[model samples]
Target: MVTVLTSGLASSLMDRLRRAAMKLALGEQPPEDLPMIAALALADGLESPALVELAGLSRRDPPADIRDLFTEALAELGLPMPRVEEAWIDRMLDAARAMLSGSLSPYEASDEIYWCLCHLDRTDRVTEPMLLFAGLWSNWEDWPDGRPTIEQNMREAAADLLRSHGEQVSEHE
Candidate 1:
């Protein structure tokens, strides 16, 4: 029970941090919840050096340099800080892998698929899982029976991709 709860908390924290980092990367202000998020990391006992650097900041102290440093800190914390393009691809890959692994549901995967397709062009980073995701998403309305085959293909492709290209989330998380 404790392990599950901790894993859930870490996953939640990683999501928040990733979103904030992406916004900063895109020349946007950090989320209003940034301070609270840092606090939660400390509360959860992740007192890593990178996090300590963040813990020293005042809410109003951020600037463009801060944006770079913020992403750098995430990298130091063992997060896979991808470029915006690769980030979407990574998210898509994660959704498929998690769905196959039973860590996420198809309902959740659908939302992930939608966001990835929105960000990604059809001509690039066309991984096998992406192809399967596109097919599964487009035909879900008319082909209920197709879910099994698509999911089966997804399971195989996602497993193979995960072996070679999956993000290595921090153990501290």
Candidate 2:
């Protein structure tokens, strides 16, 4: 068996790295490629076992297979490994649905939404529903456990935003 050793970057820490890459990609001057993104993360003083491994790869002679290495790193980091064009939007909607389904905590979802919105590339493509979601759902000062009505309202708003954005809500939802 040919066992592949991963950098073990698949967790919240790596998720933060993914957000950093997204922010950079959305920035005025995006990096040329994924390795540059990783390099910039290293330049930004973001360090981790996995990030360090990627950085080492960046220093290689000829830097052969950087794309492959970068892709592998993302996979190990539980990042947008599939590299689908819609991965970012899909992740946002999926995270929101998980929150509604009780699989993901509201606080985590709120944080993710806040981060996503702050880093989003605001262009003509942005819609009113996206704005509404950012204004309404991203910030929750106090999500009281006893208030089922409040949660329901949040869920409804999220569902509307998801539907407007073309995300299919679960049948049970």
Candidate 3:
């Protein structure tokens, strides 16, 4: 029981720490609007035009993982996964690079990526898990050539370092 209690306390502390870090990084009282916007975009499968309108209303970025999250979520909902173009992959990679660096936070990254998807050309939008997946891919220790983007490499390195210390990534709620 003592061990369980200690573990619970540690987990709770970690949660608090993560929240504090995110809030500090955002530099503003983070609004709940971003997550809600994400949820709305995910739920409605809002087209690019609609998404642009949605972005205008958001104080934060749109759902970053809409493509992947939607794919998974829609699968569960017994709906077909929407087929966004593949060129979005490159855009996602670029966005991921920006995100990994201090140039952008995950929230900002997710927001802009979603914004581009909603407003930018068909190929210009960064679609996900591919966006997210590539960021993961470029981080491999075994990759002979360095990652095409410094930001992605940094993100991968940071994630790896954190994992080594037993830090785990959680889904955004």
Candidate 4:
């Protein structure tokens, strides 16, 4: 299992990603929505447009492996793919598969995924949503009685990020 210092921002983004991934996996949402949802989750980070573009590219040419898709997405966004150890990738893949198969809850899976992403970010020095979200999530936890407003702040930040990137972001509820 991967570990991360959870904060409100990280929790919110993880929730958003997990929900989007689940919805996509369950066929509740169209493939095109993935990037938009990712953009919303990532806010104004470098990964947002890349995710959106990745979804578009996936529609044109789907990759066989999800990891490949993720790599390609980052590359499409002009970001370098982090060099993660094969062992870590294998472990994450196993965990992710378990999550998709319903052996793990979305929350658990997202947390692990966040850690994996963080590991990659730390190793590569790249700016990714998972890394940023993890930091924010950790910082938020230090604040006194900050939970209630954190979610809203996260959304607003995401919206601001999207708008700054010239992408139209809509708040979900």
- Per TM-score, the best of the predicted structures is 1
Candidate 2 vs candidate 4: the lDDT winner is: 2
Candidate 1, residue 145: CA error in Å? Answer: 3.9
Report how far off residue 79 is in candidate 1 (Å): 4.4
**Candidate that would win on lDDT:** 1
Q: Which stretches in model 3 have alpha-carbon errors above 4 Å?
A: 1-84, 115-173
Winner of 1 and 3 under TM-score: 1
Tens digits of per-residue lDDT for model 4 on 83-123? 33433443344444444455764345445545655544354
Q: Please, what are the lDDT tens digits per residue for candidate 2 over residues 11-120?
A: 43355556544443344222335455676656654444555556665444343455455555555544654333344565667667777788866556645554555444
lDDT of model number 4: 0.46
Number of clashes recorded per candidate: 0, 0, 1, 3
> All models: lDDT?
0.59, 0.54, 0.40, 0.46
TM-score, per-candidate, Cα-based: 0.60, 0.44, 0.21, 0.28
Ten-residue stretch with the least lDDT total in model 4: 78-87
Worst 10 residues of 1 by lDDT: 164-173
Residue 56 local lDDT, model 1: 64
The true-versus-predicted C-alpha distance at residue 32 of model 2, in Å, is: 20
